[model samples]
Target: MDTAKVVATFSVGIAATLTATALQVGKPSGWDELATGLLFAAFLAAIVVVVFDRLTDANHGNLIQLAFVHGWTQERLLKELQAATIAAVDANSWVLTAVRISTVAQVGISTLSGIVAVVSLLT
Candidate 1:
């Protein structure tokens, strides 16, 4: 999750740089415009991923805190902890899947944007 956040942050920076360069090229061709749009989209997507991951982490932390607060007896606390563990596993699985999909999307869009930018420059 931390790695995903780091990569997403890096991707956003790259996307911004690419978009700025595309805009500065002056009198962009259709391909340059397309590259800029795709870079913007990629940047937005990375931001969303980072936000969603942070939210999910906060929610899980709250859940764990609630479990400790509510559990009265030793047995109850153990049970609560076990339940929290299961829930965490499920949530982490889903989060990992989402991160994987978003990472693939970011990479694909960034690659395509780079290609289009290069083509625009060459033509």
Candidate 2:
């Protein structure tokens, strides 16, 4: 999770830098404009990852709190904890999947944008 956060953060920064570089091409036509658009899309994807990550963390925290709500025998508490754990995992699976997909897209798009920006410079 920490690694994902770091990578997403780095991706966001790279997208911003590349977008700025693309814009520096003055009129920014052809590949330069496409690079800028793709960079913006990558930036939005990274932001989505960040938002999903925060929501996942919050969900986990909520599950933890709900699992330990006092009152109940040790056996009952264990059972409840197990059930909550399973339910939380099931519910959060999609969110985790989204974060993974968004992170991959963000990095991939940023790399492509960087390449396009370079190509624009050469052309």
Candidate number achieving the greatest TM-score relative to the actual structure: 2
Q: Which segments of model 2 are wrong by more than 4 Å?
A: 25-27, 54-71
Top candidate on lDDT is 2
Residue 43, model 1, lDDT: 80
Once fitted onto the true fold, the runs of candidate 1 whose alpha carbons sit more than 4 angstroms away are 54-76
lDDT of 1 by residue, 11-54 (tens): 65776676567667768789878988888887877776776573
lDDT of candidate 2 over 1-123, digit per residue (tens):
567778977876776676677668667778877988888888788777778874322244554565577555667666766776787677788878888888888889878887888777777
Candidate 2 is scored at a TM of 0.74
lDDT at position 81, candidate 2: 65
Candidate 1: worst-modelled 10 consecutive residues by lDDT: 54-63
lDDT score of model 2? Answer: 0.74
- Record all residue pairs in model 1 with backbone atoms less than 3 Å apart, i.e. clashing: none
